[model samples]
Target: MTINRRKFLGATVAASAALSAPMALAAGSGKPRVVVIGGGAGGATAARYIAKDSKGEIDVTLIEPTRTYYTCFFSNLYLGGFKEMDELGHSYGGLAAAGVNVIHDWAIGVDRDSKQVTLAGGAKLTYDKLVLSPGIDFVDNAVAGWDVTAQNAMPHAYKGGSQTELLKAQLAAMPEGGVFAMVAPPNPYRCPPGPYERVSMVAHYLKANNPTAKIIVADPKPKFSKMALFQEGWANNYGGMIDWVGEEFGGGNVEVDPNGMTLSIDGEVVSVDVCNVIPAMKAGKIAEIAGVTQGNWAPVNAADMSSKADADVYVLGDASQQGDMPKSGFSANSQAKVCANAIRGALTGSRVFPAKFSNTCWSLIDTDNGVKVGATYEATDEKIAKVDGFISSTGESSEVRKATYLESEGWYSGITADMFG
Candidate 1:
């Protein structure tokens, strides 16, 4: 919970010295300090792996505003009442144990020419190498009449935290037969199948608590990840309780009246008791300020995750533009390993091995049923290309679904261990 300033500063100094010592020795004697921005999946994984693998040779400092992280992967279960908030939250104690310098602060901007990151608290950190994984920032203008303040009434819940809690509360307090509308974002968003999976979980909760309640999905894309499986599951599990409007049906277009909880599409204004509008997203503000992001996402070399705009900097997670990789936490964690290895090699002047990465994203349809999509990728000519993968098959047996559910939980534990523990 609360980090003691003396203890935290002591740990940070120790961690930094540990990381920089090896690089310093390799360079005929000065440690190389690495400052990693963000402490979610990518940043935490990179910091932990670098500190552990380098054996205190590379000084690693991690900057994060929050003391804990709530994973978006399984957040749907929280809405379904299958998991508690604490179950989805993870702390950074493991990183500290691994000798990572965890700085609880927000990065305001980066001085690329000087290799320094400016913190919101007016601290400037110099780094031999910088890794940024600040995650996504929602594009408020993507949806009309929806801003930060307006979102209080129609919660997006896309990024977790208070928004997620607010959405859950609204769902719980809805009238017995109230309508809940979810407007899913367009392509290239975090967790391609997340919105549908969320709808399934909400429907599951409604079927048990408020049987007459209805859930509607206004999808921007006609086809989604695990489309067949989701459609099949929805029909069999909650028939007539869920309605889906694909792109052809004007579900792809969305305009919001946050005050009225209404969505205007195809010249029609439909009112809902509760609305969740997941807008388009881009790299975090830090990335933009650092000149690493091109449009909405940061562009990095696939082989090393080094920013195309700045070689000394690397970007990962939903913030990076890894063409073949989905913006899932699993992908971010995997990319962190690659970034770690690259940083180690860069600091030590060693041969950097070819990078290969893999990701698996699991979505819980309900408490027991789950579906997954996985893939392996490699870098070629500075671009990532998927080599193998499979989306879960439609109508899988209950036993298989149960197995996937267990596997998903195992992955969450394993990933957390890899990143923090």
Candidate 2:
């Protein structure tokens, strides 16, 4: 089923009463508090929705370390020069004005037993419900000769903000005919098509400034999302400027030398001007600290995104191991609405409705050249199952491609407004 703004609010209420869970607040307490960690698409949207819809009946506090959040969604456009850094950065002022208690602090600990969160600033906050949308953290030793300390030399521009800016600057400073290399991540990383899109954007930038510069991608996966479409776009737009090596060709067996500025792919060492190493990812440290993560990710109930380990806790976005959904911003935003509705129902004795979700991921191949893939999902007994889907065609008219790009532009504006406001 598809969900729009109106349908989201007008969900069909169930006849049964809300489930009774132990209230974290004592009787006559001012309000039942909800503590949300991470201020990205999922957490921000959930905090805003619960606060706005509850009408002062519940207290919502959002904990994020960064004061200004740079969205990972459109950050590629910034690297391609289609957008500015300011355009991708959003502030929490709007969420604060909408009644969310936005706290700029790191959530250092989550005590599920006590229903309290400890911050790095030495503050403790109690909550009736906890939401974790902390995104992804890289796995140590996932890539040879790469670690957090080497991120300065061989940067992993996976996360938003400074890392993105660093990569952009590196692209601009490439020597004439310089070699730019990227070590792609394994499966289930955030945004499956992200690294390929970055390569396209990087190629776009180099074609204009340093036409002789080249891009080489070493991917662990045999094939990625929108593989045919991305390959077609690369051939049509980038021509002979890009090369991709998959697992079948020894891309999976690779090592890097950050100090030497070289990558050894299939035992062939090549000196590189800039190396972007995106390693394997897992739920952020706080999720592991909470004791909710089974392995790398936290499993959640499809209906409400509640943690399988703890009903009082919910996990969203890339940190969640929900079935079928790609770890993308659009998916997280959709899941957040479903989670918010359930949280409000359980805490305030409001109406609870069946959960339905939808997501669309748009990628710009080049200037005004766009492609997309999306699906609608419904909650089943096992997981969030896909109902139907659509994807951009390999061969399409320029007019159609441009229209798709425009549609993506509209979506970016709409979703950001929905999230921050």
Candidate 3:
């Protein structure tokens, strides 16, 4: 019997709701307060779960800059013309209805000692436990001749929405036989398979309209996630259109000149009509301001996703350096559930389960042809370690590939509902 993922999600959420034993570990007087920063998968899910499971026992607030969140998970499909921009956008109304105070503002400062968060709008919120899920931000000057200012010209488009649209526009307007160059990010970035999926999407678009258009990828990492699957798809669907240069071939040594619309690899400069420069990334700025991040990412306790810098603070999603789990929306959502249960148990003496996390990243190789990689993880005392994993085989039949794509579509809907409501 085939278990539908959408139905499974509904059942899982129902089980969580029914089984929550909210033991009363009440503080002196009123309800305990929790503050969550960032509203994409991690923060929003954490806030909603805390509020919902607490059964009106705790006050929860979610601080985010945008009223609507755009997921980076399937943003590549937006470029592929398989999904519209609106499909990637979700509102916070559902979260608010679940008793989470959704504040649409940037969290600019985090005070560890005081357990307070200062917003860009000059407001302050105090929390008994603070959850930080601020996503990725590029390392400044990581790529030569590329900076925030140059992003308007070259378009990193990694953040979704406007940037995604900008990249799509560039792809549509490229001249016949024009060169499209991509400087892929290094390891430990958001969604390890994201850049390659993007290349496939762009190639799909160009193949239909401008068949002669070419794509050049200069990748810092020698091997990427799902490398074999992506390469096979590219060869089968977009043969001879993609030129992937790995680290050994000087892909690691890349410099860009946005002013001239050029990309230089291994000292060989090529004038490019359009460029997508994805720079090295680190935990978002707020994580650094919170002083929870060490090096580029924040370290967290495996049990509760609490930051090592301060037990009161928990970091999740792409901003965190948790073991085994890739920085994807699915991973973030899974981590949020574990973190939420822990926080609730701490505040109200609820029955917190052992942290068991899972993630599946689905990528579209061509229209209606998708592949995926996934794993189940358990939290060790040291880190969140992988228990088991699976990947789509290289030579799958067309029917199997199409079914996988459909499964991904089902998962997207189910996860969004789980996070938002």
Candidate 4:
């Protein structure tokens, strides 16, 4: 029906009110009821598209804990003082207006055999097909003394929301010439270049206000996305203001005391003005309970994002293990579109088209300057493979960098619109 933002918001309100309505009245006796878990990039997109493209033949229910979502994609700009939190946060009103049932609740568990989801409120929802995109959960014991309580003392801020705001506050409160420590997690996490991008953003702020402030990146991996480019940029721009320690230099070392505001690396205790510890990650707890996660992430067929463990369930975004595709928001959003199409085809006995996906991640080195990495992929034999893309050229021109920034903004708008509008 060509729904836009205003119409989408109206739909969300109507759908929310209909939640208490009788099932027959809510479904209207024809549409198939599809329940979606989580309302970030993956679930929101799935709900919007399934409701819109199905032409009222499908009733979509979205379960999420929050009404608003703050994206991690452009959060670095917020840290650089170039953007406000409101600019990064988006409301679910648009999705509501799209005829999707938006429920503000956390899903406690899923019954794969019965095709039902149980919420903490004792509400039970049965679905013909279920889509899960619950995102990642941090591994508390990845480092000693690092747990839920420890996270407050050393903000990971990877998932955005309160943790993000806390990290920002800590940065603002740090003394001049103080130390900021960032412990980058191992590979297969939500965002590979996120820690480094944050380093650049914080360095940009420190250079102007606290020039003597230091940023130490203790990375588990020896190399990271666009390592050479980031190194060159830091050396030329920040001039020794940032130091990166790879695995060779004891960067992999980690021990923490949540109460003492101290971290030990290689048995040497170090105290910093601020600390950001990004622990290892796995699929959300629900995914584990549903028997979808193999080790840390759920395994799915690349062609349709169908869970190998359960035929009726689909997993996308950071929770699924899609080879050659980094767990970034752009990738998740793109994958959701593909998965949505696959679900529709499967339900209607239509031919499911082969899947192709794309991703782009932009990181700002400073205001008015940024870098990007992107890739396009095709699925074959249940695995995704990269086709083509570009990493920002080293020492690219000002015009090129600016163009990338604009393109990234456009991508964010377009992807969000595709999911919610």
A best-first ranking of the candidates according to their lDDT comes to 3, 2, 1, 4
Q: State which candidate has the highest TM-score.
A: 3
Model 3: per-residue Cα lDDT over 1-421, one tens digit each: 1225667487657757753774785767878999999998899889988988888888999998888788888899989899999999999999999999999888888888888899989998999999999999999888988998998899999897899999999999999999999999998899999999999999999999899999999998889999999999999999999999999999989899988888999999999998999999999999999998899999999889999989999999999988889999989999999999999998998788888898889999997798999998999988999999999999999998899899888888888888898
Worst 10 residues of 3 by lDDT: 1-10
Error of 1 at 202 (Å): 0.6
- What TM-score do all the candidates reach, one by one? 0.93, 0.94, 0.98, 0.92
Q: Put down candidate 4 lDDT per residue, 94-168, tens digits, no spaces.
A: 988878989999899899989999998889999888999999998759877787777788988988688888988
The residue pairs in collision within model 4 are: 8-97, 11-96, 11-97, 12-96, 12-97
Give the per-residue lDDT of model 2 (tens digit) for 1-421: 2333443333312211132222233356588899999999999999988888787678999999999999999899999999999999999999999899999999999888899999999999999999999999999999999999999898898889999999899989999999999999999899988888888899999999999999999999999999999999999988999999999999998999999999999899999999999999999999999999998999999999999999999999999988999999999998998999899888877777799898888899999998889999999878989999999999999998888888788777777778898
What TM-score does candidate 4 get on C-alpha atoms? Answer: 0.92
| Residue 390 alpha-carbon offset, candidate 1, angstroms | 1.3
Better of 1 and 4 by TM-score: 1
After TM-score superposition, the amount by which residue 54's alpha carbon in candidate 3 deviates from its true location, in angstroms, is 0.8
Superposed on all Cα atoms, the candidates' RMSDs to the truth, in angstroms, are 6.1, 3.7, 1.3, 5.8
Note the Cα lDDT for every prediction shown.
0.84, 0.89, 0.91, 0.81
Between prediction 2 and prediction 3, the one with superior lDDT is 3
The best-first sequence of candidates by TM-score reads 3, 2, 1, 4
